[model samples]
Target: MRLTRYLLALFLGLGLCAGPGLADTPGVGLKPDLRLLVDISGSMKTSDPDNLREPAIELIVRLLPEGSKAGIWVFGEDVRELVPHGVVDSAWRERAREAVPQIDNSGQRTNIPAAITAATYDLERLDPGYRTSIVLLTDGKVDVAESPMVNASSARRLLSATAPNLGATGIAVHTIALSNEADWPFLRALARSTSGIAEKAESPQALSSIFVQALEMVAPTARVPLSDSGFAIDDSVSEFTLLVFFGGARNRLELVDPDGARYSANSSDVDWYQNQQFALVTVASPSAGNWRVKAPDSASLRVNVISDLKLDVDPLPNSLPAGRQTELGLRLTEQGQVLTDAEVLAAFDLSVVITGPGGKQLSIPVSREYALPADGEYRIVIPPFDAPGRYQVVAQLQAQSLQRELPMYVEVVAPPEQPTLVTRGQEPPEDDFQAPLLWLGGVLALLLLAIWLHLRRRKRRKLEIWEKRARQLASNDSEPLEGVSADQ
Candidate 1:
């Protein structure tokens, strides 16, 4: 009990400091915002050889594209934007170079989720014209707080929450794991979710090369302006999705399928981004032939299409008892076939939304590791419901253009009925007398033991008294016992 109390106290303490606060004030930066999130927690001071982190930052700053704008954020227990995003001129470069050394190893905790969130905020502040990407460098696993609630699962949920923001803003997150202790899988997933890259650095000296590699990944490798000339996919291709990114007011865009079926930006399959800068359309089993597009020539388009990845959640149970643990299954497939290997689908986001009897909603946290344990089967454990009524579990996956929501309803029944034994041709067995008999026997045994002890004590006292009287009589006879009195 004492140990349990101590552990509860510890968790409470951690929960108090779990939040990563907020990011620093907005800095001035345009698109192509390379937000460098460097870990400067106390642990880095030791893991970093000769404190070479600063030198790596200096090298990255020097190599930044002259046309691009950037910012520097250092994260530990708290996130601080050391240098806000600004144009990469000689002056800005020099400022960044000097500011690199100013970042000291003074932080005591490494709040990785907060760092990602802060970087996302920085990119969000920029216009859609500016391509946004983040380069995260860390040497340890997420250690935001020391508590039972702050584990790898918690970190994943935090990442899941921030991933959509990055996706909506088209901000890629590239990560460089500095040491073996780093959460490499989580970092890789974060990068993959945003269409970025993940790499590892053997030592601090290798940081510069890895940073360049990340930069290359974030850089635009190709530019094909889609206007009068539209791209097409042959029938040989299985599935594809086209993401059209633009800026300014909404453009009137049209897509013509191989069968001459016309689809506008308002089509059901087409999703117009709330950001007002992009439209996403998924074409499953694309038909062979030339697909045409019609749009205002003034509107520029950057098209991104991918294939061979799809997420689906298995059917949920029709009914569940209120306040009972229930597991929801999820599956991932490629081209309509379920995937046997879990690693291939680790980059996707799987979450659960629960609606209670009172219309209250809650999102449960899930971990990637849990899915692999069951080979692509994600079992989401739902807490017992408090009221018996209709409850819902909505399983959702946000992977690139293939976002799916699967909701299942279950009617929570009241607690199980108590069974009563029935007998034919005989009176119902009265309450078993064993309990009363046991109690009576216990009382009788205790009374008998007490009486026996009392009798033994009394016998011992009588014996002692007789022995004393006999000794006194013998002594009187030995003393001549008043010889005259005896003769009388």
Candidate 2:
């Protein structure tokens, strides 16, 4: 019955149908439809004391591409939509950034089910060309009530019914669990069942990095590598955004362009947002040459760009059956055309680094020799994945003047084991088989009946203990807790 309730809720909330013209390809060039669900329950006051979630979310909002769709929701005893769902344009991004400050840890309970329902409500109405994903950040269990059993039952319904339905409809639910007390098992299961990534943050400071990783999973961006706080802006790069991380002092970040002209937040062509922890800056039509950031030696920077030159990896399936080998295709393209110059391809070293379920690393080199067709695409055969868990694959390309990395996540699932059959040289006589089967059936019936009675008695004893405790509290003029049904 609980599963039925979950299904009904999901049906009404999500529309329970694949959108018309949904992309048949799993992980190609589809645009992203991202929903961010943040938990603002009381426990977050400890887990994220400084409220770094605000800046972390702002980082995501600023980095989103112009055409994608996104929305933000904060959850506690109930769910509230902080940002309305719409196409990601300049105005939408500004509104989302403004809404980030409203997230706070002041709620009485963590109602994850309600949050999911609200975040995904009417998601089927979106354009079928986009890939739907939900990034759920939480710091506690499903605490809709005082009883742990009730919370556990709610979790079960969510995993058993809702998660599968979401996966079936091509929606990924990426989960982030904060603090040691967070419900890791439930969060991990929810992500695994929906073909999403599961991440844990031991400290609030880690939320920003984890948010960046989650963004990579949902909507990866083309990045221009930053080395020693310096990077080159090629002619193909139309726009570039710099994410600089720093600590200690509150100082303005400055950039030195190709002509050695220094620029800061006050510069004409730069858009900058700064907080205590980090600063995000976007520069349009940057000059083509070497550029450097003026920051402390200990500071770090990441440059993401919108460019004509890009590293393209073949789309990876959301999941793969265990012990199956697959081929991965990689290529370099400039302005939508594959690069076929031998000298250009020979300048870079390309490799694939795979992290398996047990944290083992496997590095496979992508041969410089192009395939028979002479196309720029490089192909590598991924070895059979023997373990049943999530695998992270990163394709890295490094050359004298450029660096690029593409990260992809895939889940490997083991098929159910078949029962082994034992056979004898001779079959038993029909009469003997009939008699033994009847006797065995009687014994099994008796065993099942005994098990039922023992369970009933044990449940009754537990109920009596709870009832006694409740009555004692009531006698002391304390608030009485709600009763839990045995069926739960």
Candidate 3:
């Protein structure tokens, strides 16, 4: 019980310090430190023939918030740093975008261990203010050598040595297997052991979406809901970016602002980066009204915004023991102050969707009754977990003008097996209780036998003493008679 209390206290302390927050100031919250590792082995020539990973990497780089740190590494037989690790800014984004073209299927071997080691080389020291993670994408097995034994040995080393080391340093290693031929078991185990996520990209076309999901898990940002390519921009929004996936359409993408003014790639105020698969556009000081995107028929859009109104969620721990109850805390803040307006609070809808092992999902609606008295924080208690496996919790918050989703991953470990008590009239398992019961019975019988022998010996000794005394007394008494008898 003392150990459990200590662990819970430690977890609470870390959560309080490392949780992400959004404030009116730009860099006043927890920052994300993400390392991306891409596999460039020869098998990628078939797995990713269209090279969709390039755009996926570019999209993730562009979407990273300003204060976060990110770097890229490409691995084949060896590892090469494509982008220098640094704070995310215009220059870093540009460097990452330029380096995306260098990714190709030119190498001979998939050296996953080397890639992980190189990517996490500088992450030995942990920063409480930063959330560090690694996103690894691969398409083949561990084939660093001709001998299968050597490859298997490398995998074992990774599981036994590297994964634990990374977990100890609080670095999550999210793995993405790009094809069916990839070493999925190894990747899954690595991610699960390190409190990260494991994903599979069935085709090259699915890489970008998977990358976006990973980004959400690593560095979640508040978003404005874009329904049917249209979203609302309020006074709180300072800037917003539109990530439009056009599905290889050749048509120009245009954005309609609140004033119904259309802007395209050639617009003076918009920064646009176009690719064969998607177009990323950024607008500063967006007008307060409705905005729409004009793109191809099948285009999908996501709007990420910078605003003073934010929802801050407490961070979940990497792993939890089974049957442990967890309380998830969330606060709605505006301009660095807790929002207490009853009208706005009434409009807020908060809930969580938990996906457990084997694709089981549980939806929980967080009621306002769970809110604290005066503070604008809502503490929702999660149901105690019964099963043990990886679980994904997505906290969704929606208001009249804003929507945000935070994706968190956690591993639920089975608790230690406890000793079972045998009740009266209930038979215990033979394997557990039979030998001990037999030994105890044998000990009791031997104790009874020893006691009986001791009592019998004592009785015999007393009898002999009494007999000796009687004999002596008779001899004494008979001494006078003995004279008479001798005389006789």
Clashes of each: 6, 0, 0
lDDT of each: 0.63, 0.80, 0.79
When sorted by TM-score, best at the front, the candidate numbers are 3, 2, 1
Residue pairs with clashing backbones, model 1: 31-130, 32-130, 32-131, 323-384, 323-385, 324-384
| Order of candidate numbers by lDDT, starting with the best | 2, 3, 1
lDDT of 3 by residue, 1-488 (tens): 32223323543554532332212333234578999999998888899998888889988988898878999999999899999888899889888878899999888999999998888777656567788999999998888899999999999999999899888778889899999999899998898778787888978877888888788778877777667778887666789888887766675688998888999888887989887678889999888778988888877778888876676666676567789999876767665656543434556688788999889899887744455324466777788878988788878777555566666667787877999886767666779888998999999999999999999999999999999999898777433434456446
CA displacement after TM-score superposition, residue 282 of candidate 1 (Å): 46
Superposed model 2: Cα runs more than 4 Å off? 1-28, 123-126, 247-253, 265-268, 314-324, 327-380, 385-392, 396-403, 409-488
Structural RMSD, model 2: 23.6
Per-residue lDDT of candidate 2, residues 294-344 (tens digit): 886666678888866577776466567788899888776654456554545
Candidate 2 lDDT at 96 equals 89
Please give the range of 10 consecutive residues that has the lowest summed lDDT in model 2.
Answer: 16-25
**Which pairs clash in the backbone of model 2?**
none
Stretches of candidate 3 off by over 4 Å are 1-29, 247-252, 317-325, 333-367, 373-377, 384-488
Q: Using Cα atoms with residue i matched to residue i, what is each candidate's TM-score against the true structure?
A: 0.39, 0.70, 0.71
lDDT (Cα, tens digit) per residue for candidate 1, span 1-488 = 32223323543554522322111212211225688999988888777847767756765675565567788999999999888777779889777867887878888988888887776674535665466778888887788778846666667785687765675567777788888888888886776566556678877766655665455444321111243546545333455455443434455677788688988756676443322434445566666556777665545443333333334443333344457776766665443345443333554567778998798999875655354533455666777777977666766655333344444555565667889887766654566676888999999999999999999999999999999999898777445455577549
Residue 220 of candidate 1: its Cα lDDT?
Answer: 23
